[model samples]
Target: MAGQKGDPVMVDERRFTSFADGETSLELHGLTFENGTDALAVYGNGVFTRDAAGRAALAAVVDVLRRAVAALDEAGPAAQALPDGDGRGDGATSVANPFG
Candidate 1:
């Protein structure tokens, strides 16, 4: 469903929202797995993990996440500052989709 400019919208139980500033903008969305195949679904991108290569791709993503978490831990507090003054920057923005 459509929402006001800044409000989160839900489509098929997946939530969508975005944030922006002068230099950059980010859109947030959810992924759902295919019922029987357990493939990860992405809008305009099709599904993943339905085959061996797809599963490997998903594992790669997980490995990257683990590495990133370790990196952030090594960086400590200085890496977590945000303009919003919220301490949640680490928890919220820590993982990024290496795929896109």
Candidate 2:
């Protein structure tokens, strides 16, 4: 969303997924956004079992790195898919846009 001079615009969130079980279990999520800059701003965190965390963490990092490189050519963190496009694309974000 955009602001209109003084009107508050609906937040154009760079949403991502997360999972958790109470406070002692696990949580995982990632997010990104396009500011008025040359690239997208991104941040994220995840929690998982020590037994499996390594694989999952590596997978997520590898994914974002690959996607960012492909999408932004290492200029800035960036990866987004068209609303209609579907594939293993865009930092592992879900390709099917239910919102669209």
Candidate 3:
């Protein structure tokens, strides 16, 4: 939501999920705007997996996303969906989307 000069603002929000397939996760989102800017600033963070093993794997995924975001920020465009590593006969494994 946006407001003129000195107007107050409010927001309504909620999150609903279908199932829990992976480790533990939590999400937080917020909106803010610059003093003289017309565009709104949106920010969010999704922490996945509090479990020891899951945390380690999730951390690696975080690193991957960090690099992907940096590339976009520097090149003024978005990065396409790319695999983290070569799939060397892992059979069937589900891929997780941290952004969602």
Identify the candidate with maximal TM-score: 1
TM per prediction: 0.30, 0.30, 0.26
Model 2 lDDT-worst window of ten:
17-26
User: Which has the greatest lDDT?
Assistant: 1
The per-residue C-alpha lDDT of model 2 at residue 66 equals 46
**CA displacement after TM-score superposition, residue 100 of candidate 2 (Å):** 50
Q: Which of the predicted structures, 2 or 3, would earn the higher TM-score when compared with the native?
A: 2
Cα-based lDDT for every prediction:
0.36, 0.35, 0.33
Residue 51 C-alpha lDDT in model 2: 62
Q: Write the residue-wise lDDT of candidate 2 on 40-97 in tens digits.
A: 3444554434667667665554454344344333323333432443433344664687
**What does candidate 3's lDDT look like per residue over 10-67, in tens digits?**
2233221111122222232221221111112223444556688667555544443343
Q: Pull out the clashing pairs in model 3.
A: none
What are the per-model numbers of colliding residue pairs?
A: 0, 0, 0
The regions of model 3 sitting more than 4 angstroms off are: 1-49, 76-100
lDDT of 1 by residue, 1-100 (tens): 1222334333346433322122222122223222111111223342455789778555543443343334334445744752453443333555787999
Comparing 1 and 3 on TM-score, the stronger one? 1
